[model samples]
Target: MKTTGNTILVTGGGSGIGLALAQRWHDAGNKVIVTGRNAEKLQAAIAGRPNMSAVSLDVTDADAIAAFAKDIVARFPNLNVLVNNAGIMNAEDVSAKRDLTQAEATVVTNILGPVRLIDALVDHLAVQADSAIVNVTSGLAFVPFPKAPTYSATKAAMHSYSVALRIQLEGKVEVIELAPPAVRTDLTPGQSTREGYMPLDDFADEVMTLFAVEPTPEEILVQNVMPLRTAEANGTVPQVLERLKAL
Candidate 1:
C-alpha cells in the first residue's frame, strides 16, 4: 500500500471503477497491468498509456484464472499488488420462480473470482515486499440493496473473507477491502449518469488520498459510503436500506 513504485494488477480494468483507479495508479508512478474478459477492450483501455498494459482474463473461468496467474507471475516478477476489482451486478425479482442465471454468474464473478485469484497469488505475494491484496466490495455489503440482492450478498461474503484473509496474512501481506458507495459508474445500466450517486472521479480522488496515508487504512470508505458502511453499527440499517431502495 505504498501508493507508488509497485507493480499492480487490477482485474476488470477495461472500464468503470476498475479502469478509473488503474489510471490513477498509473499516474501516481506505478506500473499497472489491467485485465478484463475482453481482449480488444483491454487493449484499447491501455492504448498510449505509458507503463500501463492490459491482459485478458475471464474471472468466471477457473482454469483460465489459474493459467493467467502463472503466466502473469512469470511476466511480472515484481508484481506485489493484486486488486480484485472485477465483479458483476444485476437486478432480480425473487418473488416468483425465475431463472437463476444472473444470480449464479454474480456469485461466481464477485465471490469465487477473488477467492481463486487470491489463492493463486497469495503465496507469490507473501514473499514480495510491500505486498497487498485489495478487494473491491460495495457499500451494499453492509446494507443490502434489494434490487441487486445476489450482488449485495456476494460483496458481503467478500468483505467477510477479506477480514479472515487479513488475519491469516497479518504479517506477510496487507489485505484491504475497498467498499464503495453507488459511484457514478456503469456497474448497472444508467448508473454512470445517475444524479444521486457519487461522481467516479470524485470517488477515485478521495480513494487516492486515503491510500496516501502513512499507515494505509484497511477499509477505504469514501464519504458517500459512510452511511451505509456504518449503518448497522450506528443502528441506522432501516434508514439506510430505505434510502438505498429508492436509488
Candidate 2:
C-alpha cells in the first residue's frame, strides 16, 4: 500500500493501536475514518484531528456491517483502505465450569467480524486503483496462549483467513496482516502495560515505516513476536509451550 494520500477506514479506531494508526495517517495528510462500538470514544478520537472522522459500528452485528458498507461507499467514495483492527481478548479456564456463551462472543467479534466486513466491502475495494485491507492479528495466533485459548484460536483463524483473502484478492487489492505481540493496550486491561508489551506509539511507528517500503502483501511482526513466529515455523511447539508455562 502507498504510505500516504489514501482515504482509510479503521475499525476499532477509538483507542489503542487503531487510534494510533489513524493519528499517524491523518498527520501524513490522509483522510482517515474510524469506527468503533462506543460513540463517545469514537468522537473523542477525532476531536482534535481535522482530517479524521469517526463512525459508531459494532463489527459483531452482521446487519449493521452490511448497512455500514453501503454507508461507507455512499459517503466515503474515496475510501480505498480498510483496517480490520477490532478484537477482544479474554482469559478462560477450560477445566472449570464455564459459559460457552462468553467464548462464542469472542469468536464472533474476533473472527466473524472481519470476515463479514471484508465480504461486504470486497467489491468496493476492487474498484479502487490502489486499495489495501489490513487485518490485525496477534503473535498468539502462531502459538496459543493457554490463559486466553479462545482469543488465540480466533486470531489463528483470522491469520488463516487473511492468507486466503490475500490470494483471492491477488491483483485486486493489497492485503496486509499485522500480527502484533502483546501491546500496551486495554485489550489486557492493566496487565498489558505492566507486562512490558510494546508501547502503542512505538509499534504504530514501526508498522507505518514498514508500509512505506514494502509493496507486496506480507506479515509485519514486531520485535517480541519474532520468537513465536520462529518457534512455530521450526516445529518447536513443545518448547514454546514450556516457555509459556515458565512465564
Candidate 3:
C-alpha cells in the first residue's frame, strides 16, 4: 500500500491506538479522517492537524453507518483507505453469572461493524486505482486472554473475516490485518499503564515503519505480537490460556 497520497478513514480515532495511527497517517501526507461516537473527543483528536478531519460516527448503529458511508463517499470521493479500528474490550468471568451485554456489544462492534462498513464501501473502494482496508485485530485472537474472553473472541472472528475478505477482494482492494500485542493504550481501563504492555510511542513508530514499506504485508506482525501471532501454530493454546488466567 502506498503510504501517502491516499484519503484514509480511521474508526475509533478519538484516542489510544486509533488516534496514534490517524496522527501518523496525517503526518505522512495522507488526507486523514477520523470517526468516533464522542464528538468532542473526535474534534479534540484532530485539533490543529490541518491535514486531518473528524466525523461523528457510531459504528454500532446500523442506520447511522449506511448514512455515514453515503455521506462520506459523496464528500470525500478520493477516499481509498479504511481502517476498522473501533472496538470495546471488557473482562468477563464466564463461570460467574454472566450478562451477555458486553459480549454482544463486542460482537457487534468488532465483528459486524467492520463487515457492514466494508459492505457499504467496497464498491467505492473497488473503483479506485489503489485502495486498502486495514483491520485492527489483536494478538489475543491467536491465544485467548481468559479474562477478556469476549474481546478475544471478537478479534479471532475478525481475523478469520479478514482472511476471506482479502481473497474475495484479491485484485480490487488490499486487505491488511494488523494484530497488535498488549499495547500501552486504554482499550480497557488502566490498560495503558499495565506492566508488560508495549510503550505506545514505540508500537506506533514500528507500525508506521511497517506501513511505510513499499508493499505492506497482509499481516502486520510487530516483534511483540509475533509470539501470539504464531502461538496457535506451536500448540501453545493451553499454556497461553493458563498464563492469562493467572493474570
**lDDT score for residue 142 of model 2:** 91
> Could you report the Cα RMSD, in angstroms, for every candidate shown?
0.7, 1.3, 1.0
* Highest-scoring model, TM-score: 1
Expressed as tens digits, the lDDT of each residue in 1-247 for candidate 2 is 8878899999999989998999899999899999999999999999888989988899999999999999989999989999999998888889988788879999999989999999999999999979999999998899999888999999999999989988999999989999988788888769556666788888999888877775643898777788787886798988887877665
Which candidate order results from sorting by TM-score in descending order?
1, 3, 2
Model 3: residues >4 Å from true position, as ranges? Answer: none
How would you order the candidates by lDDT, starting with the best? 1, 3, 2
Each prediction's whole-model lDDT (CA) = 0.94, 0.89, 0.92
My TM-score estimates for the predictions, one after another, are 0.98, 0.96, 0.97
Q: Report backbone clashes per prediction.
A: 0, 0, 0
Q: By the TM-score metric, which is better: model 1 or model 2?
A: 1
Error of 1 at 186 (Å): 1.1
The Cα error of candidate 2 at residue 27, in Å, is 0.9
Winning model by lDDT: 1
Report how far off residue 60 is in candidate 2 (Å). Answer: 0.9
Residue lDDT tens for model 3, 1-247? 8988999999999999999999989988999999999999899999999989999999999999999999999999999999999999988878978788888998999999999999999999999978999999999999989888889999999999999999999999999999999999988888889998899999999999998777888998889988788878888878777877787
